[model samples]
Target: MTTEPPETGLVVRYSFLWPREHDRGEIEGRKDRPVCLVVPVDVGQGAVVVFPITTQEPLPGRSAVAVPDTERRRLKLPGDRPCWIMLDEANSDVMPGSYHLVPLETHPLRYAYGRFSPAFMRVVLRTMGESIRARQLRMVPRER
Candidate 1:
């Protein structure tokens, strides 16, 4: 339970600002939600990127990876509905002092809920990579 996110694949409660919201002139997320940290592309540089997780079904044409039931049980995510890791966009923030990384109310002293399994993360990363190569990835800056 660290105050700062130390690695990738950690599921954290964050104020995730979506691409649509950003386009509508919203600087902050509509609400705090569960997000997965799938890539540690530049940990030493403090640039952490995260993909939002939602129980809502992905819109048509958007890319996403389904979260398995076992994974959901391990993480104790609320509800019994299906969840998906939206891969069409990501948010970047400087770690150790990110404005959008909110502490989980259930784990007040920690910034993360838990880490995703390596296997699941692999699937997520692969989908994200495809999005990246196809140039469908949108990077929204969340740093102040």
Candidate 2:
């Protein structure tokens, strides 16, 4: 049975394994960090599509995007930790509990670091689209 995501395009903390890393083996360690749940891959499969987030600034060659400080604050991210979205790396089979979803409303504590606003989602999608078009040479239709 295929399990769908509770919410598509939700940003949460998850441990992601970079598929391209051939040297890494039996890697039981999963790096838990911020990731954007792009879709469920049907928005399902007990799995979802994800874009890894990091604090490392994109260098002259890395295919990553910077998340503005303002947007990061709205996501209730840590003030001390800067964030960058990795456009080249995406995990398509992240399991449930691998990440989280912040709904429209949440408890004060949760809201401090919960599901982000639609506005931010727009920014993510836009950047992801730009990455795809320039790097992948393809077009991605907007979900809505």
Candidate 3:
């Protein structure tokens, strides 16, 4: 009997909201705007998880947090809701910092922002698949 290898690539989906805070000043100033609830993905081999942010304006100096693979796997991410995937670091050659899945209702704004597109999603998914495939191949035992 022949056995097929386990699927390495795991898809996680969840919802993310950008909170805006304004400071109470003479003219109302804002400070320390950071991204909240970032779950990083570990691709192994020094390649950290990536967070692809698809918003109207790219948050400067803000990044996602890298979480352990075990925690990420165990996380009960909601499929019906929107979510982001930590693929790799922004400096890494694989993927970017963050990718936001805009809700169907907010797709218009997403397009307006010009941060995300169908092509971009395709590339991201392809890269993720490749990473998973690579991991799976490494786990496979050789016939001696």
- Identify the candidate with maximal TM-score: 1
lDDT of 2 by residue, 1-144 (tens): 112343555666544556544234533225556667666445445555667778878777656667778778767654467788787667665444333332223332231144556776777777777877677422111111
lDDT of each: 0.83, 0.56, 0.27
RMSD, every candidate, angstroms: 2.0, 7.1, 17.3
In terms of lDDT, the poorest run of 10 residues in model 1 is 1-10
- Score candidate 3 by TM-score against the native: 0.21
Clashing pairs in 1: none
Write model 1 residue lDDT over 29-126, tens digit each, in one string. Answer: 99899898754664547777889999999988888999999999899876799999999988987766777877777767777778889998889889
Residue 11 displacement in candidate 2 (angstroms)? 1.9
lDDT of 3 by residue, 1-144 (tens): 111111123221212221221111222112211111212256432232223333232234333223333433344322223333333222121112223322233332321111223444455556555645555211111111
Each candidate's TM vs. the true structure? 0.90, 0.63, 0.21
* Ranking, TM-score, top scorer first: 1, 2, 3
* Highest lDDT against the true fold, candidate: 1
